[model samples]
Target: MKNVSADAINALKAQCRGEVLLRDDAGYEAARQIWNGMFDRLPGIIVRCVGTGDVIKAVNFGRDHELLISVKGGGHNSAGNAVCDDGLMIDLSLMRRVNVDPKKKTLRVDGGALLGDMDDESQLYGLAVSGGGIISHTGVGGLTLGGGFGWISRKHGLAIDNLISAEVVTSDGKLLTASAGENPELFWGLRGGGGNFGIVTSFVFKCVAIGPEVYSGLIVKKFEDAKEYIKFHRDYVRTLPDDMTVWMVVRHAPPLPFLPNEVHGKMVVVVPFVWLGNEAEGKAFIKPIQEATPSHGEAFGMNPWVGWQSGFDGLVGHGARNYWKSHHIKGLSDDCIDKIIAFGDTMPSPECEIFIPHMEGAPSHVPADETAFSYRETPFVLNIHTRWQNPSDDKRCIAWARDFHAATEPFAKGVYVNFLSEEGEGRVKEAYTEAVWERLVQVKQKYDPQNLFRMNQNIKP
Candidate 1:
C-alpha cells in the first residue's frame, strides 16, 4: 500500500459529496465492520460513496495513489473482500436507491442496495426479480455478479438471467453502460464473472410477476430418518414443476413454535420450499414430501413474499465467524447423502449447516456458453456453512466444514462463486469452464488490464 499524503486526503475530502473517514473519525469503526466477523481489517481510509460521482472520484484516487482498494456493497460476502487493511475502502452503503418501472416490469437498483431494498419496492406492485437469495440483507450487486439464485430461480432464472443493463466505472475512472446492445462483452462478463472487471454503479433488472404473497414454509424430519428422507428428496424434487423449489438443510433444529420441545436443538433435516402458484396447487405439489417420511414437524401455507425472503435472517444474522465451502452437484448419490448425515451428526456448532439447494430449471434451459456462468446444468448446490460466535472455536468449526466438503467433493462437478471463501486461485478456477474463463480474462484485459479490481474472485489479464 502507498503512503497517502495529508494534502491528497484533504483534496479528496473537499471534492467528494459523501463522508470521508480516517481511522480516528466518528464512523470509521462502524464503516469497517462487515457481515463476517472472521475478518477484522483496518483500511487506511473509508469513502462513503453517495452516487456514481463519488465512486468515480474514489476509484481515480485509489488508482493514482497506487493503493490497495476494496469496495463495500452491503458487505455480505463470505470472503470479506469488501474491506482491506492499510488501503482505500470505497463504501457504497449510502448509495441504496431502487426505482421500479411498472409499465416495463423492470427495476433500476443502485449498487449499494440490499436485496430487501429492492424487494420492498418491487413487491408493492406484485413483481420481483429472481435470485435475491433467502437473506434479505444480501447485496444486490455481489449476488448478481456471482450468478445469484433463490426461491424463485427455478421458475424465473438466476439474477444474471434477469439483468438487463449496468452502469459501470472502470479502473481509469470512465463511466460506461453495459448491456446486450452496448458493450455486450462486458455485459456477458458481468453476469457471473464476480467483481473483477469494474464497479457497477447501478443495475437494471427485468422483473417477473411473482407475488405479494406465496405458498412457502419449512418441514422438519428427525435425524434418525435423514438418510432415507434425503434419498427420497433427491428423486422427489426432480418430478416437481419449476414454480416450486424445495431445498434441504441438515443442522441442529432451532426452537420454532411448530417443532416439539424434544426436537429443539436436535440434528434434523429441514426442507424449505417456495411455490409461485396458488395455495391448492402448491399444497398438491408438496403433499408427496409431507408423506415421504415420518416428519418430526412441519409448517406450510401462504406467506408474504417479502416475509419469506427474510425468513432465515435470524439464523444467518451478521457478526458471526463464518467459513463456507460449496460445490455444484448434478445429483445426490447414496454415498453423498450418507456423508451429509454423518456430518450433521457431528456439527461443531448449532449454527453450522449443510445446505443442499435444488437447482436446474429455468437457468439450466439457457445454453452454458451464452454467459460466463457455466454451471447452468448443475442440479444441486451444496454449501457447507460453518458459523460460530467464539473465536476459540474457529479451528474446530472450519475443520468440520472442510472435512465434510472434502468427503463430498468426489460427487461434485463444480462450485458456486458466491459461496466461495478465500480459497486460492485453483479453487476459483472451478467456478468456470475453460472457454468462459478465457473469455473473462479477455474482458478483464480490455476493461481492467492492470487489475485494480483484484479484491474479488479475480480473473487475471
Candidate 2:
C-alpha cells in the first residue's frame, strides 16, 4: 500500500468540514476500526466527516488520487466492507443529527446516525420510521440501503420502505436528492441495493406514531425443549398480526440479574416479541404465542423503546468476531425446524445464536418490483449468526454455521444480502434474481460506472 500523499492530506484538511487522519496520525488506529473484530484493514486515510460537504470533499479526493473508497456509517458490517486496506474511508459517525417535524410526521436524519439515535428522537414524539433490530446502534444508511428488518418491519415495512427521500453524492462528485418523484430509478436502487450507488448523506423518512411504551421482552425455554418449542414457534408465528414481531433464538443466557443463577450457562430458546399497538390488543395477540408451550422461564411486559433496544446490547456489540449465514425461506418446514434446533442445541459459544425472523406482512405487501429487494415473497429469514470472542474458536464456529446451513438449505429460498459476507460473486448473484441483478447492474453503471462504491456487496458497473 502506498503512503497517503501529503498534498492530498493537506487539501482534505483545508476543504473538508471533518477531521482527516492519515495512517501515521494519532487517532488513525481508532478511526480505521470497524464493528466486526475479525477484520484487520489499514486504510491510508480516515476522514471523520462532519457533514455532507465533508463527504463530498473526501470522495473527490479519493477519486482524484485513484484511491479505493469505502463509506462507514455505523461500522457494523459483518463483512467489514465499511473500511478497506489502503483506501479512503468517509466515516460518518460525527455527522449524527436528527430533525423531526412532528406535525409533518417526518424525520430528517444525518447519514451517520444509528437506528438507536433515530428511534430515540422519533419515539419522543411517538413517531418512528421502520428500523432494524431494537439495537439502536445500527446506522440508518447501512440498514435502510440494505433493507432493514426488525420489530416494526411487519407493520411499517423495511427501513427503506419508510424512506421518503435521500441526499446522495454520486461518483462524479455531484450531490443530488433522490426520492419517489426525483431521480426515481436511483431511489428504487437505494431501497435494497446496498451502497453500490453512492454515498448517502441524509435521509428523510415518513414516520408513524408508535409507543413511548410497548409490550416487548423475552420468553426463555430449556434447550431440551428446543425441538417442540421451535416447531411450535414456526407454525404459530405466521398467525401473528402485523403489529407483533418475534424472533426465535437459541443461545446461553447472560448473567442478567433477572435471569436465574442456575440457568446462566445453560442452553436456552429465547423467543423475543414486540407488540406495537394498544396494550389490551397487544396482550391478546401475544397470548396465543405465550400459550404455545410451557416455558421454564418467561419475561414479558411493557418497556420504553430505548430499554428494549439496549436490553440485549450486552450480548451483541462491536469488537466481537461475527460470521453470518442467512437464508430466506418460503416456508419453515419441519425438517428446517429440526436442523435449527439441533444446531442450537450444540452452539459452540455463548455468543453464537440462531435467528429466524418472520418476513411477510408489510415488507411483502409492497410489490416485488417496487424495490430492488428480492425474496420479498419469502416468509422467513433464518440466520446462523456465528459470533465469538476467541479467534482460536473461529473455525469451529464457522464449521457449525456451514453445517447448520447445509442441513437447512433444502428448505430455504435465497439469502438476505444484508446478512451476507464475502461469499463471492456467485452467492451475491444468488441473493437476487437474474432480472433484479441485471437491473441493479444497469443502475450501478449509470450512477457509478467506475464502481467507486465497489467496497460494499458490490454490483459491478
Candidate 3:
C-alpha cells in the first residue's frame, strides 16, 4: 500500500463526516469489494462519502496526497475501475438519497443512488427517466456518465439526453453545477464521456410519464431455431414502434418457474422486451415474434415497472467474475447472425450470454455532436457478457468472449464505453468519434489537467 503519514490520515478523518477506512478497519474488506470479483484490489484508503461535503473532502485529500484515485458509485462496472491496487478510493455507496418532483416530472439523484432507488421513487410519482439499464442495482452516476440506455431508450432517448444538470466536483475541489445553460461544454462532455472530467455528486434528470405498470416479458426459443429466428427478429424489429423495444439474448436457460426443469441448463435464445404503451397494442406488436418461432416457454403481460426492472436481478447478482466485449453495429447481417449463433452454441459457461439490444430511435434522432455519445445512429449494440464464478475458469471465459468479439468485429461500427473491460486506449477511442474525443480532451485539459480522475475509461488531457 502507498504510505501515508498517520497524522495526515487522522486529519482527513477529522475533516470528513463519513467513514475513513484503512486496510485493517472493520468494514475495509467489504468496502473495497466491487461488483466484478475478477478485480481483487486493495486500496490504501477508502472514504465512504455520505454526502457532497464528504465527497469534496475526499477529492481534496486525494489530490493533495497525489494518490491514484478511483471513484466507486454503485461499483457495478465490468472493468472494476472503482478500485485500485494502492490508491485512494472514494466510495459513494452510502450517499443514496433520491428525491422526486411529481409536479415538475423531474428527479434529483445522489451520486451513489442505484437504478432501483431512482426507479422506486420515480414510479411512486408515475414518472421515470429514460436511460437506466435493466439491472436495478446499476449506479445512476456511472451509467449516466457513460450514456445510459435501457427499456425506454427507444422512446425517450439516452440518459444523457434527459439529464437536466449535474453537480460536479473537479480536480481542484471546486463544486460546479453543469447544465445546458451553465457550463454547456462540460455538460456535453459529461453525457457519454465516461468519468474522465470529474466526480459528479448528484444528477437532475427530466422524467417522462411511463408507468405505474407496463407490458413486458421474456420468450425463450430453442437453440436449434436461433439462426432463423434471429434473422427474422432483425428484420421484424425494424418495423416496431418507438414505444416498444425487444432485445435478443442467447444463453443457457436459468431455472425459472416458467421454463421446464428439463430445459433449465439448455442453450436457448431469449427475447425480452418492454412496451411503454397500451397493453392491447403492446400485445399486437409482440405477436409476430411469438408466431414466427416456436417458443420452448414464454411469459408476457402487465408487470409493475419496478418489478420488471428488478426481474433479472437474480441472474446478475454480484460477486461473479465478469468480462465484457461489445460492439455497435448498424445492422445485423446474415454472417453476424451465424457467428452469434455459433458462439451461443459453445458458450464457455452457463452464465455467459450474447446480448443484442436494438438501439436507434429517440437517441438516433439527435445530432452526433449534440452530446459526447456520438453513436446516435447505430441500430444495434452487441454485447458479449462472459460471466462465471471461479478463478479457475477465468482464462476459458475471457478467451471465449475475446474470440467471439473478434469473429464479429468486421460488422462493428464502434462500441459502448460502459460495456468495455480493460481493453486499452484504442478500444477507448472507439467509444467516441474523433471530433467528440477532441472536444472531450479540451474539457479534460480545462477541468482535470493533471488527470487525477483517470481510473475510468479515460479521456486524457
* Local distance difference test, candidate 1: 0.92
Question: In model 1, what lDDT does residue 301 have?
Answer: 89
Q: What C-alpha lDDT values do all the predictions have?
A: 0.92, 0.85, 0.92
lDDT of 1 by residue, 326-433 (tens): 999868999988888888888999998889999979999988877899889999999999999999999999999899999998999988898899998888899999
Instruction: Enumerate clash totals for all models, in the order shown.
Output: 0, 1, 0
Give the residue spans of candidate 2 off by over 4 A: 1-4
Tens-digit per-residue lDDT, 1-461, candidate 2: 36456775887799877788877789889988888999999988889999888988888888878899989999887989998998888899888899999999999999888988888888889987875556777788898898888788898888888889999999999999999999999999998899999999999989888778788887777777677777777778888888888888777876756677898888887888988877788778777766777666777788987678767776778899989888887687778777777787788888888877788899888898889888887888888889999999989998988898888889988788888888887888878878889999999999999998889998998
Which lDDT tens digits does candidate 3 get at residues 1-461?
54579999999999899999999899999999998889999999999998889989999999988899999999999999999978999999998898999998899999989999999999998888898889998999899999999999999999999999999999999999999999998999999998888899999999999778889999998899988899999999888988999999999999978999999999999999998888899899988989988999999898999999999999888999999999998789999999998888889999988899999799999888889997888989999999999999999998999999999999999889999999988999999899988999999999999999999999889
Ranking by lDDT: 1, 3, 2
Every model's Cα RMSD, please?
0.8, 1.4, 0.9
